[model samples]
Target: MRRRTLHLAAVAAAALLLAGCGTQRDGTASPAPPPSPRGCPAEVRLTAADDGRALCLTTGGRLRLTLHGSEDRPWTPVTATGGALRPVNAGVAVRKGDAVAAFEAVAPGTARLTSTRPLCARRPGQNSCPGVQRWTVTVRVTAR
Candidate 1:
């Protein structure tokens, strides 16, 4: 009787453990882990490849965006919609080089970031082309 009880208890504990280990077999993502002791997780990094997509973040999360430009047509500085995402720095994309911007999720809301450059590269004293290239991403922030 004692051995049977122990075996049953062990089986019950194993079942509970397996149930608690959630899996994404349904093609849905699990929830984000809770923040660390510093009240935020590591900064979420983005690149030019992320353009035109939407992202989700939690309050107190950090975001970093980096975009590279061609030799002649460098990208302009980046901008944020503000309110939900607060700029951690000047928020301006670097000029004449790879652009970078950083922000922190402050509130539960939506925001957008954008930058642009002339589509056609021009030589010195040349008139710039009317066409332009743009990069943008939308961010949805949720409360932690």
Candidate 2:
């Protein structure tokens, strides 16, 4: 009687283990499918032309900014206002005198991304430039 009970217990345990293995009717195990991507526009690319323009984005997406500048009057790094967007830590490689920065959508809200450079280059030890140049854009983020 004890031997029969042990045999039944072993069979039950084996069945439970195989139940979640996702076997097909033909007795072949099927691989689990990959998770589907969620959200809209996985990445948003921006340029100087986007300045002052309103943009939309989905959560968990990236924002890439590329602005033009010269060596003497290069743009400062991009900055985002409010809490909707956060700067990406990985540095973007600059190409052809373009100033680049990357950010990630963190929450559902509005944010202003801005970058600025000097209108004219100043000499070394100069405290201030003659004028300031600016670039900015508004972004609206939502969960999709």
TM per prediction: 0.63, 0.62
- Which pairs of residues clash in candidate 1, taking residues 3 or more apart in a chain or in different chains? 77-93, 78-93
RMSD of each: 11.3, 19.2
lDDT of each: 0.75, 0.75
The pairs that clash in candidate 2 are none
Instruction: List model 1 lDDT by residue over 6-56, tens digit each.
Output: 999999999998655422456333343344564444357888876665667
User: For residues 73-129, could you state the per-residue lDDT of candidate 2 as single tens digits?
Assistant: 888878889999988864756754457888899998888888888887755777765
Top candidate, metric TM-score: 1
TM-score of 2: 0.62
